[model samples]
Target: MSPLELHTRALELAAGVIGTVQPEQLVLPTPCSGWDLRRLLEHMVGQQRGFAAAARGAAPDPALFRDVPVHGDPAGAFRRSAEELTAAFTSASAGAAEPRLRLPEIRDGEPFRLRHAIGFQLLDTLVHTWDVAAALGVPAGTAAAVDRDEPLAAALLDAAGLVPAGPADRAPGRAFRERHEAADGAGPFDRALALLGRDPAWAPPAR
Candidate 1:
């Protein structure tokens, strides 16, 4: 699948997970270390907006990159942001030999190819979707979320070949952590999650 198609699938999966979140579940701890459900949602929304802006060849609005205020309906707010992000990527894909995208957070504001940028976003969305699901106690294969992530993971692996190694390659804040050791018989999806720094067996803290 094309990067855009993969991104759309990733967003759809994320939206499904977000829609299932109960308001009281917002404070639940996720596998993202210090982030709770609310903070994770905020970061997801922010990245959607930030990447959308980057697709337009404009600097991401500093405010949008900050914590998103999920006042009233968090799901509604996220849906709007996802829609805007999809539109921006679609617009950038039109009539462009290659997209000239800039992400200020990476490589000191260097530009990246559109495919690579979309791959980064795809990886983020898929992994975070699992984070939210696991926090909510959604079973591993529930709604085929893991199934959806597998191909997206493969796509990222393919896209990675296109990115040249640079200083950021050796940077401390790499996109994924060292791959965790999985138990015997772990499936591809679980292995992929581990590769991306997520523990497949992670669950929310007991009350």
Candidate 2:
């Protein structure tokens, strides 16, 4: 699938999960360590805007990294950010050979290829979709969402080999907790989550 298509589907899945978040559940912990449901949503909003800014060839702005406030209507705020993100990517320059993006997290002002940026966003969006669903005590995988994620996982895996293998090989400034090895008979989605440093079996602690 094209990066645009993959990214659209990932955002759709995340929106689905976000739409189901209950007011009382915002405080629940998610699969992402140290992030509660509210924090995760805030991060999602920030990421959407940040990536959208990158697609526009704008320099990274620290202001764009601020978390979205969860007051009033958090879901509405997310929907707005999602729309902006979609618009930015869809309208990107098609003629540019290797579009360059200035990602906020990089700090070094180094530009990355548009496709590469989209791939990282795609991976992050898919994983967080699961994180949101799990925090809500709902199943993250629908047959359709899994179908979309499977191909994305395969693409990421192919790219992973080019990254040096070791603890130091982790994405700059991002530390993955100990990886949970998938069981022998694990399904494609489970294996994919594992490869991305997520435990497929992760759930919120029982209250």
Candidate 3:
């Protein structure tokens, strides 16, 4: 899958959650432990902006919106943010040197490649999409076979070595625990998010 395709899919998955957020039901819990619908969508928007900034050779502003919507038009706002990220990733020219992802919590002193940025984005979108689904009882991960996705998951999972397992990968030999934990390992959603810069337990910071 190309980066653009991944970006588009990421947006599609994110969009799938908009209706689930509901107009006044923003406080509903999502698959991510601590975050409600509003908070999770905020984080999603922040990620899109931050990733795009990085692609533009700028510092990642994860907190680009320090005080974003806790409750508002969840669907429209999130869709716009998704579009912004898709455009950013698609238009930016980082050349051979991929942008270096400096996510302090996930890992320290690690510089990620450019293509990996798209991969990372895909990972987060895919997992969070499932989170939204799981919390709202929506179905996901039916797009492709796990065997084919393992390679893509492997590259992103390379970063997982430094972090502790999130709720998704706590058990061994499980569906999402990763079949390749020895640096060459890979798996479905949760493992992929671990490889990217998100917490499997990703919750919103306290208000």
Candidate 4:
């Protein structure tokens, strides 16, 4: 599938998990260190808004990357943001050939290829969906609402090749942790998550 299609699938999966979140569950810890379900959702929404802005060639603003308040309805907020993001990418895809958009959230002065940027979002969306599922006590093998998509996982693993597995991965505020080894016999999705520094075995701490 194209990066845009992959990204849309990831967003749809994320929406499924977000839709199941109860108000009381917002405080549950997620795989993202120091982030609860609420904070993770907030970050997801903020990231979508930021990327949507970038797709439209908007000026970079720090606020664009900062977490937006969920204001009680995480699912509604995420759905609206996802719609905006998908629309932005759809519109941008029709414009000038091979436009490289500035991604201030990733780097203050760097422009990334449109396809590569969408790939980045795809990677993030998949991992974040897993993060939310883990927080909700879902087992590793069942991260998505639908049946597992091995091909999608493989595609994400390939897209993850774009990430630098260097000291930069350890930088403060970096989206991923340093690359680490995946367990022996891990499947494509688990391997992909591990490559991005997420332990497929990660679970919420015992309450």
Candidate 5:
């Protein structure tokens, strides 16, 4: 699958899992510290909208990246945001001669190559899908077809390797925390998650 296809699939998988969330489940804690499932979903939708805006060359607006509150039907909100993002990316990819995107959320609104930026979004999508699934009590590997997504996992791991691993880079408020060590005999998804600062063994707290 193309990068876009992989990203779309990941987002679809996230939407499917999110669709199962009952209103009560929104209060469940996720892998992201200090955020409940509702907040995580909001963040996911916000990022999708923000990235879609960037793809359309929208001017930098902090509000664009802020968590979008989901009112009715959180699953529908997520699916719509995903579609908008994919559509914007498709248009930008085809229409632009240079294809440079202005990403305000990163590096003071630096312009990034469209293809590279898509990779970043893909990594974000893969990790957040895991986050929501984990919050819902889905086994780590069972979320998003860990085995079938090996290619995406491998690609994300490689992309993560390009990120700086210094203390400052992993400091509090950073996009990712410090990398964790993967377990022995871990598969590609687990290894990639660990490399990207998520614990493959992470589970929701017992009620």
Candidate 6:
């Protein structure tokens, strides 16, 4: 996909997540351990800013933003951050090499190219939507989690290859199996969710 298309989808996905944050639900628990909804929102806001800075070819400006938890609707703040992220991505690489993109957040040891960055960003945004939906006692659509879209799925699978390979055999309490046991065969989202220790059949939790 073009940077423009990826940027547009990212904005939509971010907005979708932001739309899930309800005022009373700020303190709710989520899939990520040790982070209540508030902390998760704060992290997402900060992370988007961090990536925006990277997209603009700058190191994160720690001096600019405080880490103190802010009170109020997380979705509003998150949406603003999303706007910044879209602008950064579109501006940085819009007409340049979409093929050489790299986001080193997951595994910086080995450099991945453009397809990896786009795919990773899309996948990450999609999962985080589920996280927010869980916190808000809402259901994130299953469609976002499953992509039969061949281009996007192929992109994600390609980026996934860049993850450092583990041993071939599953160890005790392994996070994933070489094959998925889902009745209809695994989807790209299934592989991603499993990689992050989520059961595909489980609904996002509310706590």
Which of the numbered candidates is closest to the native, going by highest TM-score?
Answer: 4
Q: Which stretches of candidate 4 lie over 4 Å from their true place?
A: 139-147
Error of 1 at 187 (Å): 3.3
Give me the candidate number with maximum lDDT.
4
- Give the poorly placed runs of model 1, Cα more than 4 Å off: 60-64, 148-150, 156-176, 182-185
By lDDT, the better pick of 2 and 6 is: 2
Give the clashing pairs for model 6: 100-114, 101-114
In candidate 6 the C-alpha lDDT for residue 189 amounts to 61
CA lDDT for candidate 2? 0.71
**Residues forming the 10-long window of minimal summed lDDT in candidate 1:** 156-165
Clashing pairs in 5: none
lDDT tens string, model 2, 34-151?
8898898898888888888888878877677667776656678788998998898877846547688886665355677777778777766766777788887775463236645667
- Report, for every candidate in turn, its global Cα lDDT versus the true structure: 0.74, 0.71, 0.56, 0.80, 0.79, 0.58
Candidates in descending lDDT order? 4, 5, 1, 2, 6, 3
- The better-scoring model by TM-score among 1 and 3 is 1
Every model's TM-score: 0.83, 0.83, 0.64, 0.91, 0.91, 0.71
Backbone clash numbers for all candidates listed: 0, 0, 2, 0, 0, 2
lDDT of 6 by residue, 1-207 (tens): 663475456557557667656677777777666678787778677767766666665533443233335478676787787788778776766555643433444444234454455555665566666676665555345335337455555555554444434554333343233433444666776666655545555544533
Identify the superior model by TM-score, candidate 1 or candidate 5. Answer: 5
What digit string (tens of lDDT, one per residue) describes model 4 on residues 33-118? 88999999999999999889888887767677678889789999999999999999998898869778777756563888889888
Poorest 10 consecutive residues by lDDT, candidate 3: 174-183
lDDT of 1 at 132: 84
Predicted candidate 5 versus true structure: per-residue lDDT over 1-207, tens digit per residue: 667777777776777788888888898999898899899989989999999998899876768988998875789888888999999999987863848777776666778888777877877777888888888888564543845767666666666665557788788887778888888987777777777687877888787
